[model samples]
Target: MKKSYPFLVLVFFSSCWSYSQSIATSPYSLYGLGSLYESNFGLTAALGTAGIALPSEEFINNKNAASLVNIPANNFFFEIGGTGIQSSFEDNVRKENRNNFQFSHMAFAFPITARSAFNLSLMPYSSSSFKISGLKIPIIDGNNEYYYLNVIGTGGLNNLDLSYAYRLNNKLSLALSASVLFGNTTDERTYSISSSTTSIDKKVNYSGIRPILSSQYKMTSSLTFGLNVKSPTRINANKVQSVTVENGSGSSFLETDKKSDIDDFYLPLDIGVGISKSFKNKFNVTLDYEKSYWDSTNQSDMYASFSDQEKFSFGLSYQKAKTARNYFNRIKYAMGAHYDTGYLEIDNKKIDDKNLSVGVSLPLDHLSSSLYISYTYGSKGQITNSLIQENYHKLTLNLNLDGIWFVRKKLE
Candidate 1:
């Protein structure tokens, strides 16, 4: 098992590279930074992505870095996970279906000392993949004529984070983390008229950094409270554009090439709070609330306006204490739900999302390594005012491995 660790890591990274190429598919992704991805993974995801205040000795909780201090000394925790989405979209006129599978996240956590812990992770910050077409307009050029326009967009961003957590006392823990965000997106628009076609391609590149502060308090043995804050960030933006025209005889020619600087993109401050309680080690429940002050930024994209965003989450888990008995008794079952008033507003309507999820975790070996699987069913937006409504089902898979990374050797 020790020798296979290197090979496993290599395979995991390679798979991540391949899957990252296409992470999401949604028409709503055409706006802003694309579809914002959830940060939950593994056990947290199984618990309905509501683990901010939950503490675990056997798992790594990325939601609240302060929880890292709860990990047992000398134990190294690693997680790799991915998601598969099946989605259907509909408007008043028509419906369409799309599906995607992609890597979700990878992380590692270990104790730096008895009082401090360290964690590092990589995950998608957002994803954009959408195509829109069938836009027809009449031209009154002496003779009545019609033209069509089609638009396609793709790409997204990724985040790399490094965090540290310290146990300040018996009841309180604190954490700080920094993340580097980077990505590129491409948008192409094509116009068709009179057997000739013209296309314009625009590409935007983004890079930024943000800092987060987190804290967890053990109010009592059965109850805990957590809070986190992310500061606002400014992302530098640059654009490269090109235009091409194709004639009726199938000859294509470049029309223009340009590079320019765009306005700096702004991200708003985000705050989250959560609480969790355990019932006799058999049942656990958690509740969480988060808000982003997008309205404070006063930012707007070309097609959509920004609104303050809020999310509420709830989760429950059940498991039997380990005993020399059936294997099923050791498995954990979890369920959760969440509702979000999204940040994007179009035509005086806000895009919203709601989801319900259920999951199971199967212990793999004596070291507390486990396989986690979860499913979420959700809907986003509404079919009103010619807007699209999205219904989706997502499946998540994760492998959590715990081992001893560094050990002292004794010689005779």
Candidate 2:
């Protein structure tokens, strides 16, 4: 196992580099910071992304930082994951298909003491990738005839997180986390009329810090409750703009443009609560509710308005005895569902989303690690009100690696 670590690390880094360019291709990503990336890791992803109150000794729990306290002393845990998505978009008159593959996240957790633990991770916070074209409209002022418009956007935000967890008592734990969010986004718009073309390029860079607090309480031997809160933050942002023109003869020229500071973008507060119950190590159920106060931020972009958002998720799993020698008996099977009232409001219509998922975890190397795979089918938006409907299928693969570090060997 030790000999394979280096090879695995090499593969991980190479995959990360290859997919760093774009993580999403949905047209809906054109709004806001793009489609927000899911923070769930492999185990939680298999459970329908609803593991806030689920405690584990073998896997890192990302939903609630406080759960890190459950890590065994001197043990180190690591995970690397990726996702592939195939999506279809349809309107009243047309349909389009798109696909994307990218690295999801990389993280590690280790115990500091019997009752304390720490974790560090890097993952995408959001993503934006889209292209749209509008019908030609007559331009009265231009010497040309009718012209059509095309818009394209690409880029996204990334997050680096550090967290600490401490057990307060036998039944309670608390945690704190700090996250750095930074990224750059580019938008390009072009107009073509009478064989001549003009385009505007806009780029924005932003960075910010957000703090999170989390806690967990063991209500009973088989049940746990969890809560988390994220504070609002202001992101410093700057924009640079340029324009270019192309003649009918295919000659093109660029004009130096302006750079300016923009108003600080405000992110809203978020809160979540969850509960999990286990049935004698054979069955488990978890439920979670989360809310974001986007309306409280009172912020709106040029094309869309922000509204309060709510999400609900439920997950169930069945696991056989790990002590069983049969490989199939030790496997875990899970299924889950999710619903969200999204944060974006366009043309007075609210964009909503729903999904269903199922997954399995396969033990590897005597259970020291595991391979998790899940599939999700979902839909977003509505065809009415000039909005497009998006139907998507997503597949996730996660490799969890575990090892003991800093443990003193007993002298013979």
Candidate 3:
């Protein structure tokens, strides 16, 4: 096999010197990215929500672990993708933004004797960030006064994950993943009133570890079952700092001197099922169903404990291995849809989540080479009894490249 030495060196050194910049963050971290098996986004989430499974075959296939046992040695897979989001408040205000570039995934699989094999991968775990700002004026007394308020929020929950999988047999396999969570958040709020100006800023930083277990089984020629459990984690936000300033002197009135209490919680769990069948004419179809337990997560406050979220998805595809048509006719076409009942915990209130998505995958001449892309639109259902509810929408695109560098000869 011919190794991409330059790419390998780049990948290695980059990993070694990876630094945690304390300047920014994202809102997507609340829900896991690469949470779903495919690179496609969920109907409700720009890049799909956590818990969805992918195929587990020779391709480093997503779900169905048992399939990994059949994969050949010296296999490598790489994926890259991004998501864009547009948020709207009430019906008049519009907010649009995009997340940072992400390294979707990279994996290596090797043979252990004949029946068993091992696989390892590096992928993203979660990402989250959001900012809301508005101007407000208040009257403190009967006298004519001028006051302006500005609020800003910044941070993203990001995770780095490492995983290993062992195929027990042709029909079953087990996999485990260890993830290190790292990120920080900063909130800036300023109020200018009449002759005085006040500013408040808060920053929180955290580090922790989490784990995931997975299992897959093939029930028949057309049906497969998969399960994943994300262990709980106790993240230590040791640095919850705050600063307050008054007037034009630029002097500090108050500042935090110590860290806040440590917080810990479960990461939630997912269950999924898949079906793949072939038709007489060589056509193929695959479908997926998955469920997530957001309710199991520990809330930070009463408002945050209001409701839990759930998701559902479906995908279909058509492939022509060999056709009499032109070159493009040999490719495969696919589309999918995803839905979610948005999870919530606002002032002990529950909110609804709904979304829709579609995507496609194209195969290359070498079979392993392929391209994929998907997009989604959704909203956080009406907040009960509220004057107005908020809505959110997003788009996502992904590209994948994989191929065998060397193959063992049949008669070697």
Candidate order by TM-score, decreasing, is: 1, 2, 3
After best superposition, candidate 2 residue 348: deviation in angstroms?
A: 1.9
Off by over 4 Å in 1: 1-20, 138-146, 193-196, 246-257, 322-325, 409-412
Candidate 3 C-alpha lDDT tens digits along 1-412: 1111111111111112122221113221222221122333211122233222344332455343344555555454555555555544332232333233344555555555455555554544433333333354445545566576654554545555555667676667677766677766565677777556677776667677777677766556455556766665666664565666666665666766446764544455555655555465344445555555666664543113423455565555555654434657656555555565555433334445566655555555454545555555666534332212445455565555555646766884
Residue lDDT tens for model 2, 117-199: 99999999988876656545556645566787777778999999999999989999999999899998899888887777899
**lDDT tens per residue, model 1, 1-412:** 0111111111111111222356667766777888888867666776668988987776778889999998887889999999988877766655766778888999999999998999999999989876656565556545679887677678998999999999999899999999889998899898899888889999999999999999999999999999989999998889888888888677565745588898878889999999999999889999999999999998887657888999898999988964426789989899999999999887677889999999998988766688989999999988775357889999999899999767898798
Tell me the whole-model lDDT of each prediction, alpha carbons only: 0.82, 0.81, 0.48
Q: In model 3, how large is the Cα lDDT of residue 136?
A: 43
Candidate 2 residue pairs that clash: none
The alpha-carbon lDDT assigned to residue 251 of candidate 2 equals 51
Residue 210, candidate 2: Cα error in Å is 0.8
